[model samples]
Target: MGNVFDNPSFFSKYMELRSDYNYNDYLEHPAMESLLPPLKGRSVLDLGCGYGAYAMSFMRKGSSSYLGIDSSSHMIEKARTENAGAGISYRVLDLKSLDTLSTVFDVAYSSLVFHYIEDFDALLRNIYAILSDDGVLLFSQMHPLLTASYGYSGYFEGDYFAFSSYQEEGRREGRWFKEKVVSYHRRLSSIMNSLSDSGFIVDRVLEPIPREEDIREFSQLERDLVRPTFLCIRAIKKKSK
Candidate 1:
């Protein structure tokens, strides 16, 4: 509905599922955080910050300020309503237009949103422009392995894969809620190469697996523990003097 991500009804249901299960709390978020440097007293730009969930986490960890942007008004509204407080703001803005943001951030945090964007080069360039000289970018996406697991030709070459899903929209599904969505798959090389071309130095990469404790609680995650479902990256903007 509404291009897979902008629908109000779908987001409402999706947010419900998020809160019910802490779905992302256990997955890529923890692994991504482990790769990040201290964020205390830092300003953050949260791209595709759905419902400001990760933004709230950053703010709680002593981030000086958090600006969350997304393309869905419903998600923005829910974020503003649920996450209203000091050191936080939410806006309905598309990632393709990141130049509109004037503030330079010390950390630009995005999670599981890049695959939805078709123009990785432009998006990374825009992020590089608004980032401070030493700004760090931390983000996660659907792992290339997971995409290949679905079976596709040219798995090694840079390519795009499209699929239709009427049940869910994230790397993993919760029990209660589902919605119609579309997915775009691209090669890992293309993702990293684009970051390099956009003036970012790739520092670390992680194909996250479920921790032993996690699999102990949710035994269903044992399969994911063996095979990574998500990829995380840490990079820094190489701003020229």
Candidate 2:
């Protein structure tokens, strides 16, 4: 559950998938687009911003300043090497190392990352403390029921939930490794409860229906199991009473 960056394949895949979408400005752009409304004219912190794709999108949306933090060097390398622009920067950081970031942010966003975290409450508090007053936290995670009920991901089908993992042959020779990631498998009520307890007000949650093209491009397994994505979560820090 820790340092998912240890898997080289994930890094390699990160470079390939996200970079392609960043350049294409289409496929992954919607998720990026949905994150922008919260960041307009605000200082932003992008936690687990893989390869800075979402951070780059944030910049294009006119965020005043941006900082991206992730535990993966390979992802950080891709970000700092080519993605930095227009008052945006990337740092290699684990979630627990939140204090290393210098400035409080107006918006903090993450995508497809938090489900891997073992302790969601601690992470949420860390994120909440780092934000400025009324700061919004926008995140997209693997849908718990979707991943739990489905088998594979990526090719969009909006079919069902899936949360399974197994080992494939490694690219490099060595001891076989384990992929031990686990999800919270929560309903919408459970998700809301966690945020409410963490001092956040759940502002909105949107589940997007996939387009017809998504079902066609994907394999049958993806079509069968990949249910609609519980796509966006926008939560605002509780204002002081």
Candidate 3:
């Protein structure tokens, strides 16, 4: 999964896509921003923080410190060059090695990265261990409905969309930017249960609806009205009893 983004062609195509107005800007970012807790005086650990895109926003919102970690050295290099600032730093670290992190943070944030991880339970447990009591974990990922179907085809069969294989949770390999990318599919119930098992209290879940203006501007986003493309979650660490 990490190497996919590091591939020169994939990385270039991805950066170009993100640079323009797109779904992340129209739907996902708005939903994520709505779920964010106050960052004033807090420290943040960003898992799979590609290119540190949101690092400066955290600082501008009054976060005392921000650390963005990504598996791609190419991403970390761009982050350091573009998003570098006081109290902001970037590291080349895979999400699977999260247990190695010793510093507790007030907030753990990830965007569109959790689905790539196979062991959801272990990821939640690692995040739980590194968060301060009452710390927040906020993340977004591809909606299960979007990833449930194998081969990533037959999504729109004529007027209706095909959704299946939701009960089976495991690897789902598909093409993105003309390259094969792998991601995991877990039901909404599984996601909630894992968070509970890891001592997190689910606070909010969002399946964002594209704004009317956005839809009017980017006509392609109208498809999202039929089925959501992303899901956002906010959970807090449970205080020890």
Candidate 4:
């Protein structure tokens, strides 16, 4: 297992989990579930599209074309190998720059990606640039409250089951135990502001409450901690001047 925080593409674990793990209970959130039906026949761009799950899923639904880009060449290679399919393309890309392609998509999306970005402003700005006028953008991410989560401060020794004291930033040091990894947490307000400032219209924010069946499927500990794993969003690019 690589450092999941830093390596955007180091999602071998996630890919395996999500590849065939779509359950209505787990997907009770409309944000992720809604992405499919509307995407049939649409040209789509996926940013930080780790392992190409979401993007490839779109193409599987008969999407016209799919282009997936990510910061992790390692993950991109895996995405290319495992998820490549009809009309789908995967490339190694940096969110701060997307010169590899231009405003050629009908819709775009990303899942659990923005939280890792260091520059929210440059990221949204670049995303806004490649979108066709009024093109839709959908995304999901860890809730901003994650900044206050235990593991962030290195206060926990292991995935909420451990312990530590976060008296200072010095707590962030011990990740060498794994391979490549990097990430940054951002506030929800700041994310919304960045999207707005970058010329997009917010459609809705999806903060889902898991269902009873979900509780039944999760372990007691997971049920308690799985409070909410994702923040789904829908937005549209402002028409070009």
Q: Give the number of the best model, judged by TM-score.
A: 3
How does model 3 score by TM-score?
0.96
In angstroms, the error of model 2 at 191 is 1.9
Model 3: per-residue Cα lDDT over 56-138, one tens digit each: 99999999999999999999999999999999998899889998888999999999999989999999989998999999999
Clashing pairs in 1: none
Candidate 4, clashing residue pairs?
5-182, 6-181, 6-182, 7-181, 7-182
- Each candidate: what lDDT? 0.74, 0.65, 0.90, 0.64
> Candidates ranked by lDDT, best first?
3, 1, 2, 4
What TM-score do all the candidates reach, one by one? 0.82, 0.76, 0.96, 0.75
Number of the top candidate by lDDT? 3
Poorest stretch of ten by lDDT in candidate 3: 153-162
Candidate 1 deviation (Cα RMSD): 6.4
Q: Which ranges of candidate 4 are over 4 A from the true structure?
A: 1-30, 35-37, 149-181, 220-227
Relative to the unseen true structure, what is the Cα RMSD of model 3? 2.0
Residues 1-241, model 4: lDDT tens digits: 2326334433554454455534323643355766533776688888887667666567777789998888777778878888877798888777767755665787878877776666777777777777778888888875554433334433112465332342221112233224333455565676788788889888878766655665566543243345445678888898963
